[model samples]
Target: MIASLSKISSYKSMNPIITLSPAILGALVVLQAGLNRKVASQWGLSAALLLNAVVLLIVALLIFALVLVKADWFSNTIRPSIDFKTFSIWFLLPGIIGCILVFGGPWAIAKWGAAQTFILLMSGQLLASLIWDLKVEGIAVSYVRLLGIGFTWIGVILACKWK
Candidate 1:
């Protein structure tokens, strides 16, 4: 699996894209949060989130269209007869979580400001991700990872101004 992952550059010819994607994603999230907060202030939170979702859908559809044009894999591998009846209720959890983030993020930013909001959000992500790595991925936590987690919480504590 590791070998296959390391060969992603050979497969996609996008070594730089793969390398910089995370940083790009992080910057985009900050930009989105700020813009969404501004939109919420002008329009309202529900309207802002709705606009965000609509734009996201449009962009996603464009990407799917591009994939359909560029690759046979999507056309050939997508099953038209996917049974919604057979799907578990747990499948909806991710969408629910996404809605929570979409709504909660701007609200939090409005209340606490971006730095504190993102610091607390990062702490929550770190804690939840640690549990997921342990319980779901069956990863054995090392001392180094524990120390990193400790430092993250410490930073969070320092970053958040409690009244």
Candidate 2:
């Protein structure tokens, strides 16, 4: 992967939209958290979460509609021959966790300020990603990775100043 990336001749030739997509998404997450926090203040956490999910559903439907306009929509949609029966109960975990995040993000921001909340969130993500790399990807945890994890936790501690 590294070799493939390095072979890209020039920065100008790279796809800026794809390269910056993650940063764009990251900014949206923070913006969404703040908006959700405001909504929770006006209504309540559950109501705000419901609104968030409803808006997401509506947006997704709109996107699907746009995509459906294409002549090959049916073929594209049916191209994926997923075996539902093969999926375990674990498949539902992402939705459940997403609900938890939608519910918890605003609550956490309201309690701990966005910076602290995000710091903790990043720390959790790092740990979870490391475990995923190890167990699922069969990647070995090097000392440098351990050091980075340690620094992350230390930064979280300093940022949060837990009571």
Candidate 3:
């Protein structure tokens, strides 16, 4: 277990894809936020968010089906094992938070403009993530990490500043 934990901790060095995925997600979220804003303007926020959730559910189901087939994941001898007892109730939080974000994101962009909203969102996310890392993960807070957070806040401020 210790060996695997060490390996997992060093996964970024082993897999560049893992490190780059979040950056790609950040770009996609910006585009998604803009597209969602347009959809909300035409259909109203609740309808737009409902439509978005439905589309997302369809895509996810399709992807899951494709992966299952490609990997032969449901083969008799390769059945996936799930331990419901070991699963934390906290696992539900992300889905709930995601729903809230999907519902509120377009409204925020409409009210605050995309750039300001995205900057504010990013700022909050960065701070929350830093706190999670430091407290929940028991990670040491370093000067460099603090500096990066400081720079992120500065960028957010500049992005949202009025001329």
Candidate 4:
């Protein structure tokens, strides 16, 4: 599987602000909406509901910057000069950490109780995608959109789960 991931200079183009930003924004809204709608009560009124805006905003900015740079880099450059093996390792570190949070954090850390578990899973995936500047296979770095539906569904589930 690792060898199969031998990446090519595949061009990635997507809307920097539109594609990835919405995912982040939507997630923020989810957290906020969860609070407003009393769906995040399982988590808490203070920590889970209205407190994460600044943190999420910073994350959004980071995702925005990463997507923008990646889009431009792939666009202006002929091909990626990065070594797949080494670069994969770099990517894997964070990705694996994210995976751990998604899979293990629920049963382990117990963030805001288990009622908000769906949020844990979906938000983690969204964060992972955002952090990696998630993109599909065929964009020359001009497309900017993510799985809005996925985020919405998770948000809905969480909204339901709220106390």
Q: Rate the local accuracy (lDDT) of all candidates.
A: 0.82, 0.85, 0.82, 0.50
Please write out the lDDT profile of model 2 over residues 1-163, one tens digit for every residue. 5754676655557799877887898778888889999999999999999998899899977777766665366666634446888999998898889899889888898898899988888998899989999999998888889999999899899878963
By the lDDT metric, which is better: model 1 or model 2?
Answer: 2
- Number of the top candidate by TM-score? 2
Alpha-carbon TM-score of each model against the true structure: 0.78, 0.79, 0.77, 0.27
C-alpha RMSD by candidate, in order = 4.5, 3.6, 5.1, 16.3
Using TM-score as the yardstick, the better of models 3 and 4 is 3
**TM-score between model 4 and native:** 0.27
Tell me which residue pairs clash in candidate 2: none
Candidate 3 lDDT for residue 126: 80
**Candidate 2 clash total?**
0
Using TM-score as the yardstick, the better of models 1 and 2 is 2
lDDT of 4 by residue, 48-151 (tens): 32334456568878866776767765554543456766655467686555444333433332445444554555666655565455354333322234466466
**Quality of model 4 by C-alpha lDDT:** 0.50
lDDT of 2 at 118: 88
